[model samples]
Target: MRTPPPTTRPAPPRAPRRDLYAAGAAVLLVTAAVLVGRHIQGSRHTLSVNWPPLLASWDPHLGPGTPAAVLVAITVVAYGPALAVRLPWRTLLPVAWATATAWTFSLALVDGWQRGIAGRLTTRHEYLQVIDRFHDIPGTLRDFTHHILLGSPDHWPAHVAGHPPAAPLTFVLLDRIGLGGGGWAGVWCITVGATACVAVLVTVRALADETLARRAAPFLVLAPAAVWMGTSADGYFAAVAAWAVALLALAVTGRSPWAAGGSGLLLGLTCYLSYGLTLVAVIAAAVLLLGRDGIRRRPVLLVPLLAGLAVVPTAFTLAGFDWWEAYRLLVTRYYQGVGGVRPYGYWVWANLACTVLITGLATVAGLRRSVSGLLVRDRLGTPEARLALLVCAALLALLVADVSGMSKAETERIWLPFAVWLLSACAFLPRPRAWLTAQAVLALLLNHLLLTGW
Candidate 1:
């Protein structure tokens, strides 16, 4: 007769994970950024952004692309995970790219053609404005640094002055090819930017495993980063940087020397695209470290890598563009504008809030798991740890940029290259569907509600 089995007592309600706490901390950071940034901006006018932490304004409305954006979001939310899992690797890469392009294009169209795409890069502060300035390519390259200062004769616009000539030159060459103006530039950016998702998946599969790569694919496609990627040249920069890393990953893991050379070529281009992007080397180093075993086997890969690395700089030098001199002038010009007044104290932390917006709340939790993976010494070479190290490297690069004080605000768009990598951390979380929904909602809400100035 016996004693009844002791009551199970429901396994004592599982406590919240450290990931949730980390995510909560991120939410608080965003809240504090809004409240504090509004006060600082409204009172002293120093923050320089209408919306705290983001270069956007509070304008909530729907448009022609609203339905398309909503539909794309739902499609990805429902089918993305399954397709990412089942599609052949080759087929999956292009499909992921197409989906990303659709997501980015639809979000851009939310603001309509002219305001969103066709005119974004034609503004006074944008690259297309200076296409004529680059007519005498060699001459402009030689004199590019002269115009970075605010007081210089015919000084470049903020965007032009801030980046190396390679960035604007991309547009110049496009114009020469008969695809001038903001519309073609917009198409170029979105198409190339969409490849960033594929590039990251390729790298993850190369360095970690296909399983993690597959899990991460949907998150990359439906990233909140798409909001900014749709309009900014930074999106193009992100793709370039991602491919550079992906090529390096392949090269280290037994691909052809061509892969190494391509990686180096893109690495040089990435640095020239935006000075801040020089930090991409941080991520590159992580990839190499993770792939050190492969590197040890084929030490000859570095030859082609170094050879290709010389191509851009040598050509730029021959053409008269001096990367160092240009950056020095740009730093001086930085303080001549709002960068001088936007307090670092507020921005240092608020910038992380911008990161949260770009990466979404899911990434906050995902990063927690990424960090935990790094803690176990024995698992350092395991797939989870490899991916964690890669994600953390991107985070480190972004943190360095934030501390450098140059990126005070508008970082939601400005940090797209680094922030895109953060989305990969989403692969570590359980309940992929819920996290994916959170990502989609964040992106849709941001696109529908705010007029972002990417």
Candidate 2:
């Protein structure tokens, strides 16, 4: 009776190398399938007919002046780690992300260039139309440049007209690129910005786990809305850049408080630069707060967010700007009447899907990981509870932003992150069942879409 059962040692844990490689390959295949399917679906129109001139204008590494160069540099460095990691799956993850990002961005730039070149080719009136629009300004060219670049509250005409010329910073950057007219350049900037953002997102998710990173890689790279908006739409480049900076901040902050602060500052600038980035700021804040214990010991984590916030508006004010008027004139004009407060049924439906996707994955992850899985659970209080809270906050903020965003514009595309966040939460859960299944289904569907237009 005492010899009823022979004790056996637990089986050794399996190495993740195989799983990681499989995950990476699967994600890329799914991404490629989706893109092909979309292209085959005839959704790929020839927007940029004069792709030759545009391709000739393209410069990979160097752009123009301070801002342009700074942005491109950041874009490349932020993605540098993809080259350093040895895992085949890990390497493929970034490569896939970069490839998709480049394709989508290039497509959009071609579209813009086509439009610009066509306008030039078709009508003498086209160039004059642009100048006439600019010439209608009440002030001198210098005044117009200053006013358009940075709004002037003093002039009521500039205030009421509500359309200050294009952002001078954007134009200045374009000009340095040897772009005399900005139509195509604007498209390029937006695409690069969008690619940078995708890179940041992939990199951060990878930082969490290579497998998880691989899982998230495809959706972001092949996201329809993101590709279309970045490539097909204009004026969203800065918004894309803002998103990249925000995500970068989140990734860096994972290292220490000082990193957190710098991330915060970037987050703050994002808020200033694009109304869309308010969503990012909220997400960044939650990531910081939940991980605060990890960073609080370092303290410097608060500097960047605070400094950026302080500097942006303060600089504007010091230059004799009016805060409230500027807010109404610029901020309100850009973001107003957008994102339906009361959205259509699909809005509610997508939100529900996002919740289920995120929560299910996160729960599975929670079940899979043991209490010993967390590094500081014993000392930092309830790690699960804290993580849950932080995720919840981010979800709530995203929901609010998404809902509000829909009212303003067709933000359904940009809201892909809602789904991503939901999936990410599940990935962080303890079990693989929920996350693996959901992502698998998503990957398959996306693949089907790419391959067969479904």
Candidate 3:
């Protein structure tokens, strides 16, 4: 009898390798760009900007290094329980919520306490001014619109004159409840921080799967962007816009008509909150287009979504203010402000570096992998592809803002909204724990080493 043919075994699946080279190249490119851009900008302008000192004392009582130590300790304590336990997917939300709250409160604790919450809340400077007259909110809103549309000097506060009414509505609500001050600002930070954490998880779950969402939770809690989430109103704006994207993702996956409508309504509100948030529409559209039933379901989704979106601007119009005309004048006003002060050549690349710093090196590496996967048509309809598209759309929006020179400074805080989506890139990292630790280190360094006026 002929000898039996030897059987060959198929090779085991290969684990994906980390793209360190790509990540290193990205870092080098950003560093080179920042150096070159600053050189050119300094050569042309007087450079009167009050940049934060590279190393500054954040808390006198604790000392500079103490704040960094405290931040490191807080991050460890916050993440310890979750890391120690094997949590069910459903149970991760509460843990994530608590971790997010602690993370933000810890970062803001020294500043909020040292500055005196009331002083922090009530003090007005540059772009942000405390609403000294709460009763005038309505009139302020009207006048703000008028200033934007007709160039009438409403004598409005810089914050009011510079942004849509929705921007100040949060503070107005806080003031109504007798909760205005730096202390309340801390509370607002924790509240919105937790909300943003939950929104991020929900969006990830909606777009991908529960397993990925659970994996993403720890990273979100320790995000380098938390350095700003603790003190910026843009933190809350990030939460709102994140949920809007989450709701839209759920709608695309056939959640409900109501979800679609809710997404549109939130998106509309975000536009009124910050003009830059309008770019999130690109993200929403990407989700809709990439979905399995996108074409057939577009009408059902668009109808209620558009109607819900129209409500916000429609109400403003009825109040005798047109959003379009207001936005038009705001563009001119924007250029006349810091947008004109900072040259585009410098900010365009510098802003990108800031984004890379905020999002973490490992996350950027993952983003590179995701984009490469897209170009080669690997896993085209997979969850990873959808997430990659979402990230790309968000980055595109930031690029547009940077190119337009509408956002010239303090992007580390102002870009918190976009950072939310970018954090999703962490889901693709090979060693998430290492990346989380790196992110924590970066946050500590930022909070301790820099004294931001914002």
Which candidate leads the pack in TM-score?
1
The alpha-carbon deviation from the true structure for residue 99 of candidate 3, after best TM-score superposition, in angstroms, is 0.8
How many Å off is the CA of 343 in candidate 1? 0.4
Which ten contiguous residues of candidate 1 have the minimum total lDDT?
A: 3-12
Judging by TM-score, tell me the better candidate of 1 and 2: 1
Q: Candidate 2: lDDT of 142?
A: 29
Q: What is candidate 2's lDDT per residue for 39-136, written digit by digit as tens?
A: 53334332111111011122222111223223322343344323323336545645655554553444333334443222321233122223433332
How many clashing pairs does model 3 include? Answer: 3
Listed in order, each prediction's TM-score against the native is 0.96, 0.50, 0.84
Best by lDDT: 1
Whole-model lDDT, candidate 1?
Answer: 0.89
Query: Candidates ranked by TM-score, best first?
Result: 1, 3, 2
Provide the lDDT at 156 for model 3: 49
Cα lDDT tens digits, model 1, 1-454, are 1222221111112212666788889989999999999999999999889989788899998877788888988998899888877788888899999989999999999999999999999998999999888879999999998899999999999999999999999999999999998999999999999999999999988988887888899999999999999878999999999999999999999756999999999998888889999999999999889888777888889999989888888899999898998998888999999999999999999999999999998999889878877887967677888899999999999999999999989898889999888999888877678888999999999988889984
Off by over 4 Å in 1: 1-16
| Candidate 3 lDDT score at position 86 | 51
Give the true-structure RMSD of model 2.
13.0
